[model samples]
Target chain A: MTSAVELDHVTVRFGAFTAVQDATLSIEAGEFFSFLGPSGCGKTTLLRTISGFIEPSEGQVRIGGTDMRGLGPNRRPTALIFQNLALFPMMSVAENIAYGLRVRGVSRSARREVAERLLDLIALPGHADKRVDELSGGQKQRVAIARALAVEPKVLLLDEPLSALDLKLRQHMRNELRAIQRRVGITFIYITHDQGEALAMSDRIAVMNRGVIEQVADGRTLYEAPRTAFVASFVGENNAFVGTVAEADRDRALVTTAAGPLSGRNLRNLMRTSEAVLFVRPEAVVLGEGPLTGRATEVAYEGILTHATFELDGGGRMTATIPRGAPVPKPGAAVRLGYDPADALVLPREGFAHA
Target chain B: MHSSVGHWLILALPVAVVLFYAAMALLDRRRAPGARPVSFVQRNGIAVSTYLVVAVGVWTVLLIVLPQLYMIDLSFRPRLPPTQMGGPNDVYTLENYRFFLYGSTRSTAAWNTIHLKAFALTILASVAITFLNLLLCYPIAFYMAKAASTTRMRLLMLMLIAPYWVNEILRAFAIRVLLASSGVVNQALMGLGLVSEPVDFLGLDLGLYAGLSYAYLLMMVFPLYNAIESLDRNQIEAARDLGGPWWHIHLFVVVPHAKPGIASGCTLVFMLTAGALAAPQILGGPRTLWFTPIVYDRFYQAFNWPQGAAYAFLLLVACIVFVLATMRVCRLSLGEITR
Candidate 1:
């Protein structure tokens, strides 16, 4: 019911601009995959390459062990749901859904029956006679999905289809989309800039930046053990300390910064005297204990958590997130912060430009 | 009763036209496909004060209705002699219209053809020109709107419009010169060895068709470009992703989306070609006697103003009928066409 999609050293260029540069990846069958990135990161370009909307300037694309050379979008066995949905406005709901079926020479009665069944699947059983303009935003989204599924392709590609919806509806449709994908058991390749959507629904994620794929890993592994500076900063919030490594071991390194010496696990095999950065998650920062001391500068009260920012005595700042119910130290009061060696990550410094 | 009769006498046509609009509105509200039915007030919105409506009513009656009523009145009067022009004996009768129907019966010569046959030929030629312009301009418009880059599209638009900067009569006369027997086209044909002798292009009625088509080229291209420009490109891509072929995609998606533009372009080109007098008179050979020229001859050359008005009135009716039939076939509303 599903097929794996593979890209081998694919590069796409538009005259003087390089859109997607030398990309290589393989997505497994029946897996919910996502490409998450900021805008202009070439995630959409890579998705379009896979869906055959774009032909790579160099290299090959394979789907289910078959080379898709010189194949157009219409010739491939994949369907793309556009960002704006792009349902035919001149058509009724049923006609929009049944369009692919009709194009494939399906009988009129069969098309109607299939359209009706898909309408029921999308939870709009009696909306066949309604025009597209009459439907709500969410209903149009479901109709777009139903229309794509009527062709029953081996892979389904979505291009930020939920970006136009309100927040509440976007969250609701996330669950609905996941449930439908699971029931259909097809490969779903979703593209979005929203990390929440990727983390919640995808089995694995490929974080892209500047036309390059920074990292690809399962959701848990990607969050817990990001390999590069871009991945660490992009996936979630982290307190960064720039310094030089003072001591190195098999799995641990001590970095010397202006404030003090900090110890963390050496995930990137740091060497002594090498420039490095130590990252500590806000949740892992412990108050009232261990090596470093600072004065509390600001305390922000979120609904479920409290974030307290500490200015180290020498330089630099770090934030500690505590449960809201926990008592908070007064602002301007001296505070001590520490973390377990395993909770901190030390890696060689890779310069990453901020937006 | 006398007062009621007086009111009816003044208000009958206006009341009928209003009733027609009401019936159309009701029908539109019931089953207008793919568009929302907007009420007249909704279309005008809160800015439509009573003063605005009254101004529009006055303008319509004064500018459009009164002139047509005068023309109808003139069409029914007898053509009096020069000494008796506007005299009491210039009685209202159907004699002028009867002349158009039977005047050619007195002349068996082929050169003085019947008025009815000429009118029918004019209509058929106009329809053919409309279809030809559509076939030729649609692809160019689609390319300009969808395929060509912005720079290229701008250049193409400039090229299409640059010729129109010259007067229309000047353009037609230029075409007539180019299509003459000893002009550049015939000289090229002879030089290429396709023909040993110069062919008379005017005798073939080619000059008239070419001039008319060129005169109305912009009228066809702009509307189609506008319509195709507004189409969402994603819709075409979606259809392709669903495994539809190129022509099938056009048939199901692009053509239907451009229907309003096509209808408007066809109507304009058809009406202009049908009522054209200058192009035919300049480009036609002795054999090309179109309806407008015949009407013109009646008024100016033959000094028969009543009969000329009758012929003009018939041409107007034919144009209206053609417009209605086209709207019916395309399933477009007057509002959509005007928009």
Candidate 2:
């Protein structure tokens, strides 16, 4: 099957500053893909490029195997949900949904039918005559989604549509958005700075730093086997130990740190004496018995799990999550933290080391 | 003393309303959360607040209300000589108004067609000028509000406003010079061979329309800019993303958002053009006659203050009716238009 959207070496520049550089990727049909990054990471620029708002300074954008050069946004088969949702405040709910169809010269009754069906899809049945401001934030979000889907574009671009909602609502809408994308069965390109949002909703995630795409992978792989130091630090909480490679092999390597020698799987296959950072997730660090030790500086109990922060004997800090029913450590207690070699990876400290 | 009490009674309602709102504002400020314990008197100081209230009251009651009330009273009275004032014949009458219908004619149906024609033409031309100003200013306002950079917008605003610093009559004369039969416009047209003879723009009343539209161009542009500027640009993008073309986007999004501004601008331009005397006088051709000039003749040349007051009051009524009609058509409240 042809890709729903493709970007070939897309580089967007504004005078001397480059917002997105050499972003080449293909979004498969009916797939939910997310560009995850911090603010100013050029994720939004790439989304706008696909939506035909900003033509890439250098590269081609193709939708359904057709070159989109010189096509205005009104002609593109893609719809964008703005960051603020941008619902027409002057329009009623049904009118807002039917706006695109009305622009296409569809009859009033036909447009109303489409609007009612989409409203039902967005779980907003019987809200057709309500004004835009009368709806709640989440309802407005669903309405915005319904309005975008009304156009029936091949690919839907959403620019952090949930960023305006409360935390609980954002999480709830994430699942709702995923479900809607599945029902629509269209390609979804989501942009957000929230890693959890991207991980929770996206089928495949592209992690971006500055203007470059660092890695693209499924959630599990992105968490378990991040290719870059940035992704490892950004995707989830981690305890990073920076050191030099003492010994190297195909699948595992030993790194010499200030505290002692640590061994982990070699994801980047570095040579001996080369600089590397070993990353172990907070949940993977065993706190009872291990070769490395630290003094517990802080311990926080969060119902299901207890988080313990340690001042390492080597001169850094490490955090570990102790599951419920485990003996939680108190401050000033000496604790041993260890991880299985497979759960931790030693990667070349090439990109951003901290989120 | 009895008449003085009656005068004070006339002012009572407005004064009470103003004081009520002031008291409410003070109470709100004091009762708000995190407010300091200072009283209104402590916040504004007794002398300063008193001065401000007194100044505003004096300006409103003395300058604005008194003149309008006097004019309304005079509109109903006869233009008697001072020696005969308050005599046996010094009573309220509608003779000044009836004079408007019959000018100097004895028959009612054989009315003052010339003055009536001038009145009708002035109103129609003012409406046309208002519409022309709206059409001409919308794109410029949209460009300034949405498309231009900050520096460019500032520059455009300066260019639009720089000419207004000159006197209004001087600007009218400038328009007259540019639109005269043998003026620069005709000279250019003849030089370019666009016409065989001078077009006689002033003779055709094109100069008057152009002058009036120019006189109120900023009035239209600023309100439009204010309304359009506050619109979230993402809404425009959202419309386009939904496959709305340019005109459709404007129709569905931009224009709806700009309704209040359009209504206010049109009202201002229409009222100002209808009451304009200087521009008409400066740019009017040999045969051009506007209602305001006739009213001016009643006041100064004819020295018929009652008839002048009557004509001016009628024009004011017409303007208020236009404003009400605009409000009804645009479905906007008075507060929204003024806002």
Chain B: TM-scores of all predictions? 0.81, 0.88
Q: How well is each residue in A139-255 modelled by candidate 2, as lDDT tens digits?
A: 999999999999999999999999999999999999999999989999999999999999899999999999999999998999988998889999999988888999999998999
lDDT of 2: 0.90
- Point to the candidate with the largest TM-score: 2
Across A1-355, the per-residue lDDT of candidate 1 in tens digits comes to 3248988998999897888888888889999999999999999998889888899999889998799989999988899999999999999999999999899999999999999999988899999999999999999999999999999988999999999999999999999999989988989999999999999999999999888888899878878998877777778888888889999998999999877899999988989999888889999998899788999999999989999999998688989899977879799999888999899998778656631
Give each model's whole-structure lDDT: 0.88, 0.90
lDDT for A208 (candidate 1):
92
Docking class of 1: medium
lDDT of 2 by residue, B1-339 (tens): 333443454566556777899999888887887966776568899998889878988899778876776677777778888887656666677878787887752346568778878888888999999999999999999999999999999999999999999989999999999988789999999999999999999989999889999999999999999999999999999999998999988888999999989888888889999999999999887788988999999999989998899999988898889779868977889888887
The true-versus-predicted C-alpha distance at residue A188 of model 2, in Å, is 1.3
Model 1 alpha-carbon miss at residue A276, Å: 2.7
TM-score of 1: 0.89
State the lDDT of candidate 1 residue by residue for B1-339, as single tens digits.
433443344457765887899899889777967787665677777568566777887888767776666677678777777776556666567877667776652443443346778888899999999999999999999999999999999999999999999987888889888989999999999999999998888888899999989889899999999998999999999999999998889888998999889899999999999999889989887787789999999899988887888999999899989889889988889888766
**lDDT (Cα, 0-100) at B79 in candidate 2:** 84
Task: Kindly report the root-mean-square deviation of model 2 from the true structure over all alpha carbons.
Answer: 3.4
